[model samples]
Target: MSTSGGRPRRSRSTAVRRRPADRRQQILDAAARAFSEGGYHAVRLDQIADDAGISAAALYRHFPNKYALFCETTSGLAERLAVAIAGVESDQPDPRTELSELLATIATTAIDNRRTGGLYRWESQYLDRSDAEPVRSVVITQHRRMRTQLIRIRPELSRADADLITSAMTSVVASPATHRASLPIRDAQTLLRDVAAGLVDVELPVPRLEPPAPAGLAPSAKREIILAESISLFAARGFHDVTIEEIGAASGVPASGVYRHFSGKAAILEAAFWRASDRTTACITDALAVSSTPREAIVELVRRYVEVWCGNRDLIMVYASEIGHLEPDRRTALRRQQRINVEEWTTWVVRSRPELGAARARYLVHAALAAISDLVRLDRSSEPARIGPLAQRILLGA
Candidate 1:
């Protein structure tokens, strides 16, 4: 029988044909899925080849190298994002209407590409600066356009205020990338749009955390630089993907000199983990000291948490993403440290909101932390300081 479109149905035994372009697209789609789930360092070329139903040598014929393939895939994804945002219904004169439309459109795109698209949050670091530039440009363009629209809609907003609000709005739609929370696409889109609206509708205060002074505890300046540079490299390239030579070059040390500060790469990683964990504990302690009540303490905790994270986004992201790659013993210790940090917040939240059982209070604390984590790969707007208070309010449910 012919279908409604008047095309006759093919026999069940008939074989479908794919054009060269279709084959190429199939490879890209397969590669994107493989890369996103396994990460750049963890995913092998043979794995991608298998996923594409091709031999490893055949895969090389399609793309020169893994780096080239990754760049192309990410650049294409960014282009899709640009197209989606630009297509948002813009005929409405009200800036708020446009904002809402934009957020919905972004949410739909994110949900549709959730399987492969969200992988960029973890994998984009593998792309070199030269390869990443085009993707960066496209994202910058979208952010600029969105921020301008936000300022027009709310004329009272300073450029910085507009940026903070825009980042928060973007964070809401981008939240899906950081977690595996599943919902119907329509429900997810609606939920994100409402959250974005709330973030945009509020006024955010400037962040108050002063820049941290260089710690006196480092063994030497060279060691500090090595640790600092290693964190940046690890954050950008994934722990397993980065080499000691690369870290040395970045840190202005020879490969042999790296051994002087730390016995091995894992040692550097362990030190970095402890450093981040210590900083987090210190921030929580200092914040609690200044707040008079449990409720205020929770608020301070949220604000300071955001402040600490924003300042150390690269170190923190790398630490969280690569902690699993560490030796089992070290990984377990760091995880316990992470639990302590969580408990600190959970306890304060329970004390402040007595009606919430420990279980529910812990959930809220995680939800708030999840919101802050959304800012990881997102570019900052002109007023990044406003994100601190906005995140704090989100944490406190204010």
Candidate 2:
């Protein structure tokens, strides 16, 4: 088929040709946004290519596979953060000023990369150890830098305390990535900086020594065993990746036995969620009952939350990451329960600080919770007592 003039009409292609370096950057930017929004397995190469305004073949020309692209995207993000604070000097005359400036830089970087910064939090689990290590190393280095400055400001802080506070502070600055809460850029930065700075003065509780495990273990019911195994598996590998058979095997039961104990994997997940919700509700009740004032209740609530998170890190991980895989009705119910819990905290927060309107109180509540949850998620050795005080500082603005 020819045009009316009997000559083939040349179609004008809308694609813009990019230099090699520019095209690579474009692909990485698109992939980072994609992976941050959708988890690793859910994102497709062709989709990223489309986002980058390139053909699939063109995408392949730069990166061999999606894994490579993902590694590059995440590593690039970590490197960007490292660069943001590279010039920060701990030798500055005023340690508080130095830390403040450092936090300001971090706040600005977090806001700038808010769209894609979440990949390191949620999707890094899918990365291989070799691919993940460099990214982790970069983050650890940044944390060390912040810790150094924090120690400089507070000379009395022990190495462990400095590390814990630094982790909490960084988590607060990075909290924007994990949620969709929006604020003006300047307001967001100031909020993060102020909250993080508050953590500097937080007095960590003395680290408690744990007693050794008992020599003998009491036998648990098969249902409890299955539930426990499923939570660990789901936390270690996401819900979608684990199978009923695998859960059964881990629990030393057959797949048929697992069905007898629970309906399926989703049922197990739902049970885990209910277990978490019930515990949280119990803590809230206990906190309110024992406290004489709203401030005391909030502090007690933070203590309880930190204890629960530290003891049940895997369970908290499952609760945070696997909510999307639950049945719609169950998911909605659990989410509603979460909102109720947050509302309780927000109420106490507003009562404790009437100057802070309900909206700002809720904002602080989320920031404090995110700071605690993320620190627990990232550090297995995080002590509850230490984290509890930092969380209190954030919430109480102490």
Candidate 3:
């Protein structure tokens, strides 16, 4: 009864299922886990069925094939995005805060809710017209809604410029460069806040959001191994430089068996990237719950962020140096994602520091990113403590 894959790769020989409702949810849940872990291409119905404790034949009875399942998976994510943003109506209040709440939700949803967001992030490969128009239309509409919001917030700007800024900011959120390799470290919120500051031109501070770790909540040893190996592969080679073959060998999984966990290279890359973004965002949100003042919040936020940025420089190198190597369509989609991450950061920059105009804030945020991203890709690790002090100087004037 389980469906697998973003678009489940189906076997023609499987028998069709009979019960519609129960069967569909079973398939969808399995599909969700599978798609979230890998992506559409890696999903296989046999695997889904096994996860669901059903025969492959039973799965096909409800859904026609893999493509059918993919359509179902990605169907409403973008529409919800549009709807969520559209609900943030407020001309009387500070436009910057309004945008932050709206965008923060997007970062959380896109970065955390793996199935829906994963489809939003990675399903472009299957977006042929023959596939379906609903998901595509929803995403477009959501983007358009965001554009309108940008225009209102920056009333001094031209429509084209507003659109451009909107486009650029959204791309930042989705970018792999902003994604942390495997944990909700500090960089997620920092990168998001940076992008927003870059787009809107602001001097607001980054806020911390993570809470203290509870018992039994730390990452497992297995997760660490995956991250350490991926960092090497992504750093030395580009995204495509190391294959699942290399990753499997480095991580100690059987090459053929890697598909059991991750179906393809891109999906694996996406997962690794997701680990970075999700953990970062979680950290920020958690910190926000406890920090008493904006300055303290910003300090902790930046401290965690600098540590993460320095520690994972190799992964950042792999992500940045190799992203252009992705197929053209993926490149475009990821560009949009990258924008979102930046805009999230930019929002905080604007909110916390009202001194600079939008233009100046935008410049500073992007400039800061430019200054720091270089350090991220550097392979030399001799000077261990440089990033923290430097980041404090940038944000805290300490």
Best by TM-score: 2
Residue 125 of model 3, lDDT score: 45
The best candidate in terms of lDDT: 2
* Number of the candidate with higher lDDT, 1 or 2: 2
The residue-level lDDT of candidate 3 at 265 comes to 70
lDDT by residue for model 3 (1-398), tens? 34764665547677565555577777877776666444555467898889877889988987888777767766645555656656766453666666666556565555554343545544454556755566667666656656666666777766544544454455444432243333242345454545543466422232224542343443546545665677677666445457777877887877775677666776666666656666556656665566676556555555565556665676665554444334556656655665565555555555556664444344434434543554444324312244333333344332
Instruction: For residues 1-398, write the lDDT of model 1, one tens digit per residue.
Output: 67789998877677475436666677788777766655566566787888888888888888988877777778878888889987876556887778788888877877777767655565346677777778888777767767877887778887766776776677667666544544667866776676566676676665456764554554459898899888888877678877889889988889899988898888998898899789888988998899998878877777677677777778867764565456667867876877778788878878877776665555445545666766643543222355556665544554
Clashes of 3: 61
Worst 10 residues of 3 by lDDT: 378-387
C-alpha local distance difference test of each model: 0.71, 0.83, 0.56
Instruction: Provide the global lDDT of candidate 3 against the true structure.
Output: 0.56
Once fitted onto the true fold, the runs of candidate 1 whose alpha carbons sit more than 4 angstroms away are 1-26, 37-42, 51-54, 122-134, 206-229, 232-263, 274-298, 310-314, 317-385, 396-398
RMSD of 1: 7.2
Better of 1 and 3 by TM-score: 1
Ranking by lDDT: 2, 1, 3
TM-score of 1: 0.69
Error of 1 at 191 (Å): 2.2
